[model samples]
Target: MNQPEILQLFRVEEKRSKSSLRQLFAVVWAQLKMMLAYKSWLVMDLLSTLASVVMYYFVGLQVDPHQLSRSGWGTSYLAFSLVGVATSNYLWACLTRLSHSIQHEIRGGTLETIAVTPINMLMFFIGLTARGYLVSLIYLVGVFTVGVYGLGAKLSFTPQSLFVFIILFVLMLVSNQALGLVAAGIIMVYKRGDPLVFILAAVNEFLAGVLYPLELLKRFPALQVLSMLFPYTYALDGMRRVLILGASVFDVNVLTDILVLGVFSMLLVPLGLKMLGWGYDRIRREGTTSSY
Candidate 1:
């Protein structure tokens, strides 16, 4: 082949390789545009985040610092609760956004059309959920910033600690995606709200230590056992230790958390995919793919 012809061929191949990424970006951009169209909701979301920070700050103040340290987190209650709050936001996004997106597509009569497209179905759902996950990360950062500056919450992070924190955060996201897929699958087949999502949310709030330390749950063995089943319990605890306590990834407890989260991701990802495919097939067969 001529030099110019070879160059042209390579360009085409590059474009083909990037097609999936382009599609993913398109999905995220569409969601962002839709969100921006409702300027009021965006503003209200920010205000609500601020309100949460204020409420949590005051509540944390009521808890003695000595008692917070005694809980084994080695930080003030405000700082510890900040991490829990931030992590829980991502969990909420995962639990609701994927299922809601599917419901929205069905009610809008676009589910069938999209299902017929050549793009990967899993990637499409991932892209849809990615927008909400990104927004939740923004909310997390905003809340933490407000806590540090406005609420007098101390957040100390060295470069090493920050690196460990990012690794754990990514693992948490992958682990949470499994739960999102299961929720999405439930929504697809049922064509109605999934009670599991609400149940999980309540369980996470009360049992997963979003607002308090899981150490308290140790007193109640049943509740502690239930909390252990949800990966967020470990995630929030590990994150607080690494970020606030300056623990290393190799620390015994931190390493255990990583191993557990990694195992959950490996097991759940395939199971989630299988369940989603089964659910989609059932809906298609029942002629309800586009039904709300």
Candidate 2:
């Protein structure tokens, strides 16, 4: 190719990348604005989170401090539960956003329009769910602030610990997105109920240690094996150790947790994307992309 032609191609590629980025940002921004406009819902969400913290705080008070200390999570059950709750918030956000996006578009008669668009499906879904992720982060912060300052829960953190926690959190999000994509893919083909999402949520809540410690399940070999299959188990456990126990990322157990989470993200993300694309193609071929 001529030098001028090569430069022209490079410029064209740059412009395309910029355009895709802009489209992603535009989708995220639109959802953010819609979230802000719903003032009452935001208020209720905050209030409900605070109420849960209060309930947990009281429950913590009833438990013996020595017992919690023996558990080795920390001296505070409130702090332990706060981390679980925060992680669960992210889970709820991921499942709801991804699983519902395709369904919502179909129900609103916009799926066909969206499907026909030139936008990347993964990027489009990421942008559409960005707002929910932001809201979930807000909820997490509010819960932590109330738990620590208002409810007398003690939380220990260092810069390194915080950085590691952030890394684990991002990995958790990616892993959850993988499951979300799978759920979305199933929805696209089935065109109706969300059995995958519901079943996974219920199973994770019990097995992944959302409301309790994974250590509690260790006595049951079968249950522990089942828990190990879910990525959230490692994510939540690692986060709790880092945030509540102030463990370093380099700690042997923590490192293993990180590796497990990384593997889950790496494996599940591609598989989920492939499954989603396959389902999308099937729906389009069958002339049911817009069906509900």
Candidate 3:
């Protein structure tokens, strides 16, 4: 290509990049403003977190710590349950945020605008969720603090444990984000709520050991097999090992969880994008983009 042509192309690319950035910032700012406007939720968020910690702490006092230790879930029942509750809550927020965002946009009659806008849809979703997840993250930190300090729950904060926790947490988010994409696509086409969100929540709560030991599921052979179908099972197990046992991601037991999440992300993410595009195009083709 000629030097002038290359320079013109570079200028066009620069403008496009700037425009995309502007679009992203606008979405993030709008969400932030809404959060600031409805400030009552901020107070409720921390208050509810504290309540959960206190409730669980008392409940933990009634449980036999040795039964928990036998399952390798640590002797402190409070920490075990807090990690599960916090992980499940944060993950649920991440997993449903996208579909909820879509439903809100549809109600506001902005789905059509999003469909036609010349913006990066991926970045659009990222911008859509960034602010909300930031708040959820802050809530998670509070839950951990109250559980560890206020309620006397035990947690190991070694570098190895932190590394595994970070890996599991990120993988957990990535894998769940795909489910959110699929759920959002379903909402877009059906003009209804995402059943997948609730279905997964129910499954995770019962089978992922969010508040119980996975070893206890052995009594129900069929349910034990069913639990293996969900990635949260591994993620939660890995998290418990990291937080309670201070295990590294590279450790044999934890490595299995890492691999499971890695595979889930590799498969689900691409499939989710394709599914969302198909669903969105189908809705737009039917002239129902804003018909929530």
Can you tell me which runs of candidate 1 are displaced by over 4 Å? 1-18
- Candidate 2 lDDT, tens digit per residue, 1-292? 9999988987783334437788898788888898899999999989998899898888877877777677678678888888888778888777667768778878888878876767777678778788779988888999989998888777766789889999989998999889888778878898765866877777886798876667768689999999989888889888888988888989887899899999999999998888888888898999997778
lDDT of 3 by residue, 10-120 (tens): 678444454778888888888889887877888887799889888889889998988989988778889899888888876777667878887888889987797686777
Enumerate residue pairs that collide in model 3. none
Model 1: per-residue Cα lDDT over 105-188, one tens digit each: 988999899888777677788888976887797799889889888888877677888888888888888887788888788789
State each model's CA lDDT, in order: 0.83, 0.83, 0.82
**TM-score of decoy 1:** 0.90
Give the Cα-based TM-score of candidate 3 against the true structure: 0.90
Deviation of model 2 at 243, angstroms? 1.2
How far does residue 60 in candidate 2 sit from its true spot (Å)?
1.0
lDDT of 1 at 30: 84
76: Cα error in model 2, Å: 0.9
